[model samples]
Target: MKFDKAAGENTLFDNAEFVGRPTHRIDGPLKVTGTAPYAYERHDVVEGQLYGYPLGSAISHGLIVSMDAEAARNAPGVRAVVTTLEIDPLEKGMNNVARLFGGAEVQHYHQAIAVVVADSFEQARAAASLIEVEYEKGDPADYDLGAAFERLQGSGEMDTDTGDVEAAFSSAAALLDEMYHTPSQSHMAMEPHASIVDWSDGDQMTVWTSNQMINWNHGSLATTFGLDEDKIRVESPYIGGGFGGKLWLRADAVLAALGSRAAGAPVKLALPRPFIMNNTTHRSETVQRIRLAAGEDGKLTGIWHEAASHALPDGRGEDATAQTPFFYASDSIRAKHHIVTMSLPESADMRAPGEAAGLMALEVAMDEMAEKLGMDPVEFRKVNDTQVNPSNPEQEFSDRNFVECLDRGAEAFRWTDRNTAPGATRDGQWLVGHGVAGAYRGALVLPSGSRALLEGGKLVIETDMTDIGTGSYTILAQTAAETMGLTLDDVEMRMGNSAYPVSSGSGGQFGAASSSAGVYAACMALRERIAEQLGVEEAEFRDGRVIAGDTDRALSELEGQIDAVDSIEWGDFQSEYQMATFGAHFVEVGVHAGTGETRVRRMLAVCDSGRILNPITARSQVIGGMTMAVGAALSEDMALDSGRGMFANHDLAGYEVAVHADIPEQEVIFIDTLDPVASPLKAKGVGELGVCGVAAAVANAVYNATGVRVREYPVTLDKLIGGLPAIG
Candidate 1:
């Protein structure tokens, strides 16, 4: 089923029994009861499984001089040892910027160099520590983005340009130019990158891993291992957490496979917490410059956004200017991005990716521009809202309610009650103020496939879609149940297996929309098959019965089980419509007058991202994003040891995330609407949109509380203490 035309009055729209309802997670019981088998805990699947521990390179960049694994091979209970020096560099995965294993040359710190296999995890870890390695360090790596930006200023690529931005800025009534910095961030998922691989079969291998994309990893493993795609089977039914860190095949999976092949037994490997920061992918730090020019009426005339971020030579940089071109109405708009090769670590997607860091600078600049114009921040954003893409005026937004989000959010947050004068409203030693920022994230969809089986009066749906704690199982069940006119209790969903039909695989916030559409398509196929079996041209499924004119037959009365397989492919609808999610973030904070400490009192996010599939799950995603935003605003920062080209604070103790005490009240409001151009499900993505502008809103609130505008991220107290108002 190709979604070529705009969806109109479909079953999901007219007779939705579960699609748009607030359904609880179908897999909640398994998770809460600790019965769900995570990758590292699935010890009952295979017998005689050995443990594997990986050894990482000490230097960030260098060529391996010598490696002696003799000590490790002779260590207690050691079964097999595989070192990078013995094998040539393996092929890199499609989604991986840095090589997972092999090769003598190190691309970054903590690059996997060897694997030690033993009878137990402790034995494997002990054996891995005995391996000796020598390296000839290369020239000092380029780890400073500021210096790289200075060298590549004139060579930067201009991604987008509209009218003359310079001339418009020169004549604008209000102009604001500033720079902001966001530090590199770790995913810090609850479960580490873990995998268990079994290669006992002659040429067939099976891997149970905590990966987000099953199809991608399956293909990657086949390519990297020089085996046929059909020979590999990847299963990841439950993932503890993955903020884009487990999107690709990491070293844990690769090492486990290699260890299993060498030891002639199934091998399990789990990366340490420190290795997770440097070995796996992380959100790249960005240096962004935003220049906004507006008229006296609070209408934006020119908007220029340029950013510099570091990545591996073969990797793409953080595109911090992704949303600038289409976010607001501007006659003159320009966006430029510069990528600098660095040897620190692999920089890749995390949550909202580009917009998460970009909006931290752009939205804060919006607040500064509003201040220059003496206009309210929410009002300023409302006046510049555009129904069409600013970069391409021919394309109009499918469904955008940015102004409504702003108005509704401002009203709910009591924006009018905010202290207009900075540092004037004091509650004891704390100064209170409010802040607002607009959110934007593109709604993306991918071709996804699913299989449906109707057996013993129960509907079963199968896809490779991963849950990642985002309620993929629940929402997918809801989609199939609604399409088949069955209750949620009568539907069973099986996912995260490569044998299942390929799906969108839960990234870029497109998982729920695309995967659910695929299930819907498969259900439709089943409906057609049921109609054909009943000798009818068409049939309506209701109350678990197929109705054809005057004849009605219960699905349970069918002679045998019926099955259907189908996929949802997209056409040129995206070209005709600008599908994007929009929202507004409002925050209230109190700043300590003497110590410059800040604490958030409350936060509200008003989102306009098409139809909500499951309100319960949708709220969980939004609040999770909000909690991350608090960390990005106040605590989360992966301290880089630039001199040594490594992340100094690689462990969780050094790198802080938001805790219960750090988070205050959070509210999420979804604007009720359907996006026909987005998908057959009439839904867009809200996960990324929930995070886009939240950090900026927190920064703006802090600035309002204490007239000290923080240009750098993680707005720590040290940066604000010096500029804060003098103690009373």
Candidate 2:
């Protein structure tokens, strides 16, 4: 089934029994009962599974001169030891910028230099420590992003340019020019990257891993191991959390595979919490310079955003200018992204990638610009709203209710009651204020395939899509049930197996919509087959029966089971329509007068991401993103040790994330709308949308409370203390 044309009235829209309802996650019972088999907990699947402990490079950047592993190999219960210098560097995986393992050169600190396999994890760790390594240290690597940006500025071409931005800025009635900084952040997922690999079947390898994209991991493992794709299988039925950190093939899977191959037994490996930070990907730090020009009416006249971000030599920097061109209306707009190579650990996608960091700067700039024009921030955004892409007037959004989101959020949050003057409204030592920021995350639908089997009146959906704690199972089951006119109990979902048809996986928040469409396509094909077998031209699937004209038959009455496999191949609808998810974040905060401490009083997010598949899970995703956004805005920062080229606070103890006590009550509202161009389900992604622009809202709230603005991220008390209002 090709999704080229705008979706007409489909079963999901016409006969939605469970699609829009607040459905609990189907795997909830298993998760709470401690029966769900996470990657590291699947010990019963393979026998005599050895534990593999990776040895990280001591030097941040250097060449491994020599390694003496004889003592470790002869140590207690040591089955195998694979060193980086033992073999040539493995081919880099498709999604990897840093080499996972192999060769002598170390690209970043904590690069896996070797893996030690033993009968027990303790033994592996002990033996790994005994392996002595020497390195020829390289010259000091460039670690300063600020200096790098200055050196690399204007070295690359601009990513976007429109009307004369300088002229418009000069002629504007009001203007705002400021620089904002967002530091590197860790995914800090509860479940670290863990994997169990079994190569006992000779060339056939099986990997049970915590990865978001199973198909991509399967192929990357095949490429990394120099084997055919068919010989490898990747399964991830349960993932604790990914947050885009598990979107790629990490060292755990590769090292486990290598250990299993060498030891001739299954090897299970879980990266230590500290190692997970430098070993895997982190959100790139960004420096953004934004210039916004607006008229007296608070209408934006010009917008120029220039962002510089650091990455590895082969990596693309954070695209912090992504949403600027189409987010709001501006006559003259120029957005540029500058990449500066640094020796920091690989900085890649975290949640929301570009828009998350970009909006932190862009949306705050909007707030500052609104204040300069003496206009309400919400009204300023509303005035500059663009239903059509500002860069291309002919291309209009498939569905944009951003204004509605703002209105709804403002009403729900009681925006009118907020203290209009900073430092004027105080309760004891606390000063209160309100702030708002618009959210934008592009909608994406990728080609996804699934297979359906109907046996004994039960429908089974098989796809490589992963749940990633996003409720893929429940929503997919709902999609299958809705499409086949069966109850939720009658549908079964088998996902996160590479053996199944390739799916969109869990990244980019596209998994639910795209994978569900694949299931719908396969189920639609089964409906066709069932109707054909019944000698009916067309059939209406309802109440577990197929009815067409005078022919009626229960699905169970069929002689045998029916099966169908299909994929949703997308067309150029994106070319004709700019598709994106929009939202508005409203936040209330109180800042301490003397200590400069900021505490969120409450938060509300109104989303306009087309249809809601399952309001329950969808709200969970939104609040979860909002919680993470609080971390981004107030606490989370992967402090870099510039001298060592690694995250200084690599562990949970040192790095801060928003905890239960840190977060206030959060509310989420979804606009009632559907984008036929998005998918058959008419649902766009809400996961990333939840995070975008939230930090800016929080930052704006802080500024409103103190009358002082902090452009740097993690708006900690240290950055606010001195500038805060004098005590009393």
Candidate 3:
């Protein structure tokens, strides 16, 4: 079935019994009981497996003068020491700029320069320190943001100019011009980057690694080795967490394969916590300027968002202004992005990528403009809302309920009762205030495939989709059970194996909707096969039985089993209409009068992202995103040591993420609506939308409580104390 237009009546999910119901995760028991197998823990995968520890480059940017491994290779249990100098320089992966294994040039600090293989992890780690490397450290390239900003070059990708932005803003009734800065952030996933690799007879190689996209990793490995994809098998049956950090092929996977071949035995490697930060990709820091021009009635006339970000000399900068064109209503708008070349590690996507950082600036500007206009922020947003795309007026949204989200969220949050005056509401030494912001994330789907089989009174589904602790196993199980008319226990799901058909993987919030739709198509085909086997033209299947005009028989009565495979053929829905997830975020924060420390007291989110597949998992995704956004607003920053051109605090103890104590109880509400244009499931993505505008709401609440507006991120006390009003 192809999705060409908006869904009308008689859709497959119109009366879904199991799709919308709340359900517990199917893999929860295995994870909590410590029976689940992670990549590094797969001891049974290969026989006589060895351990490999990586040696990192000491210099941030320079060439390796020499590497001596004689002492390490002759150590107690060391089998092999593979240096970058031993093999030819391999091509980097398509999504990466730094070469993985054999390269003379050091791109950044902690880059894998060599791997020491031994019988045990302890021996490998001890022998790794025996190898010594001398580096010719040149004056490291510019590491200052201010200097990089001065050398910005035009990035032609996300630039847009519609009307005269400067003239319109100059003649507006009210104007807001502000510059916001967001620091680089790291993905603090619990599991480190790990891989286990082994080689078969001559050419066949298998890798058990933690990655988001199986097919992409397979292709990249083939490209690097100059071999056909059939020779490589990538399997990641379970992943602890990705958050876009494991989206592409990393050094651990590549080096493990190389180390195994060099040692003539299977090898396993896991990146240490410090190496994961400075060696792998990170979200680029952004410096953004937002200029909003509005009329006296709180309607927007124009919006101009320009952002500058840094990357490697050959890397693409983060397009931070991509969301401004279609977010709100405006006649004249200009959004531009600039790239500054640096010698830092290559930057890539984080949770929400551009919108996560962009909204932190855009939404706060909206609140500041509302304050100047003396209007409520929610009212201001409602006044400027548009049903159609502001960039292209001919295109209409397939399904948008932003107004409903804001209205329902405000009512539930009791937003009107909040104090209007700054520093008015107080409890003991804390001043309290409430704030709201609009959320938006563009919805998208990639073509995906799956296979289903029914045999021996059980339904089995197979795909390459990954869970990433997002509950993919439970939701996919729900889809198969609902379509096959079977109990939840009667179906099984197999995923994260490259032998299965290719899927959308687990990034961009598209995995659940797209992969489940593919499963639906495959299940439909299996149903047809069952009908053909029963010698009936058509039949209604339910409760493990089939009925066709009084010829009722149990589905298991068939002589043989059936299997089918199919793909979801998505049409040009993206070209004909606009698709996005919309939500409203309300945050209540309290600021200490004496210390100016801020703490979020409560939070609420109302979302409209088409039909929700599972309420329980969807709520979990939203609250997790909200918690990450709190860290972004309050304390998460990858501090850089400018003198050394390296991340100063490059471990979990230094980089702060929101803990349980940092976030309060969060309430999530999903609007009941479906968009047929999205997919057969009529569901859109809600994972990234939960983080888009949440930080700005926290910042807005902080300002309302203390009357101190912080343009920089993390809203720290030093930036607030000077501006705070004196207390009696």
Candidate 1, RMSD to the unseen true structure:
1.1
Colliding pairs, model 2? none
**Each prediction's TM-score against the native?**
0.99, 0.99, 0.97
Q: Choose 2 or 3, whichever is better by lDDT.
A: 2
Q: List, residue by residue over 420-445, the lDDT tens digit for candidate 1.
A: 87777888989887888899998999
lDDT: worst 10-residue window of model 1: 148-157
lDDT of 2 by residue, 463-567 (tens): 999989999999999989988989999998999999999999898878878998898899999998888888997688889998899988888778778999999
What are the lDDT figures for the candidates, one per model?
A: 0.90, 0.90, 0.86
User: Deviation in angstroms for 403 in model 1?
Assistant: 0.4
Task: Arrange candidates by lDDT, descending.
Answer: 2, 1, 3
Per-residue CA lDDT of model 3 for 32-136, tens digit only, reads: 998889999999988998999999887778888899999999998998899988887887776877787786888788888999999999999999999989888
Error of 1 at 413 (Å): 1.0
Model 2 RMSD, rounded to 1 decimal = 1.1
Off by over 4 Å in 2: 725-727
lDDT (Cα, 0-100) at 36 in candidate 1: 97
